[model samples]
Target: MYRVLRGRVNSVGFLPDERLIPYLELAGFVSAALIQTFDLRYNLISALVERWRPETHTFHFPCGECTITLEDVALQLGLPIDGNVVTGVSLISRPATLCYELLGHSPSEGKFTGLRFSWLKANFEHLSSTANEREVMQAARSYIMHLIGGVLMPDANDSMVHLMYLPLLSNLHNTRSYSWGSAVLAMLYRELCRTTDPSTMDIGGCLILLQLWALYRMPFLASISHQSYIFPLIHR
Candidate 1:
């Protein structure tokens, strides 16, 4: 048996301010924000990884072969799977400028390519009651950045999100144009393949989706009692 690696379940710790809801909805992440956190089954994830075949991107079981589909991403996470592909420059030449343009504030003098989650919370967690529309929109962008870094597509560092995604969120209405669901699915698939190596010690990406996918497709592996079906299956 392969050793079970620790799954990184970085749940979004803070809820978006009320003013941010409309922007979140427009960005296609409102359903994702509604997902409640659950305990990650590390052993189950490890077992599944052991059976993963990177060549085909499917789990090989004694019964048959199966894989997480784009439809699963759409239903489970309530993200749009069809749209412009999620692509951007990973390196930011002017992080400060980008932050100021979208977030209305920039980190103090330092070489920074990413915005730390702590900094985002410290600066934008609380929107002033008398703030103008632009300030509210800026705060909303920070919240989505938090969601992306902490929950959706976090990497090994797990503390900051690259500024690349900030520019994409500049126009809230167009945020939904990118296939966020497909990007998430691709990240999860890549992580699953990487963790198949026995020496791997940590897992990243949305393990919640992976766990829920397993439970739904293989009922025998699930222990939760039946609940009323919800639009985004993650809620159940």
Candidate 2:
């Protein structure tokens, strides 16, 4: 599916075929927001980069300030882990935001990468009217991964995650033009946040993303919205 995208030039949101233009005219709002508050936004982004995995992608926060781990917070939210599903907590390792786990046999395979976009679209486009909370939590995690991974440099021998996904994702952001696809991307952004809890997704990681949303939000939602366009060819 990714093969069809015009990329870096003709489109902004990785939309397939007909959905070739960016949908958001509100970009002036986004740009204005960034210009007036560059320092604050930069600091928030730096704080987020400082927390990226630092060890593993299990959503562990090594920062000493937190009084609780995500597990404890989940318990407080009135949920417990049962298989991949949680009664109340959104697992940061599942593709739980866009309504489907990135659909891989094991956890590491779901790691977000530029190459995985087509697969991500294929898997998420068929989401049911109602969501599986567990899956949403997991998908939310992938979004976080991509966000942090944007600035994270992989170790010399480590291969599970790549650091190049977000830079490649920037091709869309750099190609801003008014299109229906951009509007759809904005909608997906709303849904991604609605499904993923901002206060608790990553021990305030989501909150950081909110503070730094201007930078990270596009890649997270536009990628999903891009994949969502796959249906015209397959289901048609």
Candidate 3:
């Protein structure tokens, strides 16, 4: 018997404040935010996972073998494929201080592990009109953090995002220099491999990209009618 994997399709409905759009663009994530709504076909995702071959990192189909590439990530999700690798210190010795510096606030000492999506929303969802430049930038960082934890690189622990990524956003202009598309692809590949195991129940990483890639490549799998082609492709 084959087990159909469940996708972790959590809601990432928060939109960035207009004030933060300029900064988000500089960080190379503004396009991704355009993909606000879509329906997840759980059965389709489960079928695809069933065909995944971990060793090859490709789906084995009767027609031919195929896989999601960096190009697919860039076009489908609008993340930067070229530039520096998306990596840094995974362990933060002083997370509180880092948060204070980049986010303008810090969790209480000894209580910091990861930032909860709820906390991000509660604090940064709305910004005052009179907010200064520093406040606007801080809110933008928090929004990006929410996107990373809730959409791009989510893991089994769905509620909180590890503080390691916060440091990367310290320089919004330089953040775009990282190959975010590559990182998203790598995480999805790892999740696909893990789901090949019979015991695995939930799938992580960007299911939106996986489903959209399949729909574009294998039109037979899609139920929606084609629309005008959009740049990011996810918006269509």
Highest TM-score against the true fold, candidate: 3
Ranked by lDDT from best down, the candidates are 3, 1, 2
Which TM-score value belongs to model 2? 0.21
Better-scoring candidate (TM-score), 1 or 3: 3
| Model 1 agreement with the true structure over 127-198: per-residue lDDT tens digits | 899988899889989888877877788788687887788989999899999999999999999998888777
Identify the candidate with maximal lDDT.
3
Residue 85 lDDT, candidate 2, scale 0-100: 17
1 versus 2: better TM-score goes to: 1
True-structure lDDT of candidate 1:
0.81
Runs in model 1 deviating more than 4 A are 224-236
Stretches > 4 Å off in candidate 2: 1-115, 150-236
Ten residues in sequence with the least summed lDDT for candidate 3: 227-236
TM-score of each: 0.89, 0.21, 0.90
CA lDDT of every candidate: 0.81, 0.27, 0.82
Clashes of each: 0, 14, 0
